[model samples]
Target: MRLTRVTTAELDRLEFHAVRSGEHAKVAAQLLELANQVDAGSEISRAELFVRAGEQWEFTQEYERACAAYQRAIDDGAATVVDARALRAGALLHLDEIGQAYAEFERLEADEPSSLQTYLHVAESLYAHDDLAGAERWATEGARLFLDQVGDPYVDDLLQELLRIRFRIRADLGLAEDALDRCTDTD
Candidate 1:
């Protein structure tokens, strides 16, 4: 394995090709191997390499590996600290590490999420775990807090995710849809 760091853009391009070829699992494994050799530094390239590897591992349904990659990213103190921790929690959930995952989630919630991404991930994980109530709580609150950021496309997209998860959770709980539910889709 090469010790020199690779650019995140290059990693993304590899992911693009891997996905396009329907061979992302193979590429994800390879990226993770590279990530293993990278320094746990906050430098842009190093940090992104770890996070990107985690994301690809997630795509491949390798939750244990994904958790490791995300943890590495977090240890590196990557700029997107919350995002990395949130992902690690989700990966832990997928690994059936319920107590650990919930502990992380509670910590994240107590700290208060500044980004809708955290809410979306936590909510989606809860929803997947059949915790509709928990999912609804996080998703609805996240959507409510970020509702005013419509003009900012990135926040809008994340807000939509939170809204979508909340909508699904509510639907699963047999709850009535409200005006806010309409935001899940234009129609």
Candidate 2:
């Protein structure tokens, strides 16, 4: 394929759009290449690029690549270190490193996550691992911290997802209707 140069600004915008559109996997390789092009002096941005790449891979179910990218970001001191770590932990869960993943989650909980997405990922990861109590704790806490007693359509949407997850978790714990939540009900 013939190559065309992509401006950094345009690249950044494309990355954001790709992620927002849930098509990040299509651009993950480009992001990884851009990350490699970053020099040591630009460590922060380099780390950020790696984190972005990792997120793309993570969302695409490419857990091994996600873990590697996140680790690179962490080792480079990415601005969103906590988020990267949380995502890395989730990817670790997918990798079946349960003991290490649980340890990482416990550690991050002490630090508290730095973003709403981190909270969501941790909660989702725990839920997937059948740690209902842990998932409920994180999801509820995420809602409390992020929703701010007000509603934005976007945050509300995220809130709805969390609520659905929590409902299932509660049911699983026998604290609610024992039948599994279809997760089909919507606001």
Best by the lDDT measure:
1
Model 1: residues with Cα > 4 Å off, grouped in runs: 1-8, 33-45
Across residues 95-143, which tens digit of lDDT does each residue of candidate 2 receive?
A: 9998878888888889877677677778888998888899988977876
Cα RMSD for candidates in order: 3.0, 6.1
TM-score of each: 0.82, 0.71
Tens-digit per-residue lDDT, 38-123, candidate 1: 65442434556667778788888888888988888778765663477788888998889999988888877887878777788888
* Clash list (residue pairs), candidate 1: none
In angstroms, the error of model 1 at 109 is: 1.1
Worst 10 residues of 2 by lDDT: 176-185
Quote the lDDT for 184 in model 1. Answer: 85
The lDDT per prediction is: 0.78, 0.75
Residue 157 lDDT, candidate 2, scale 0-100 = 72
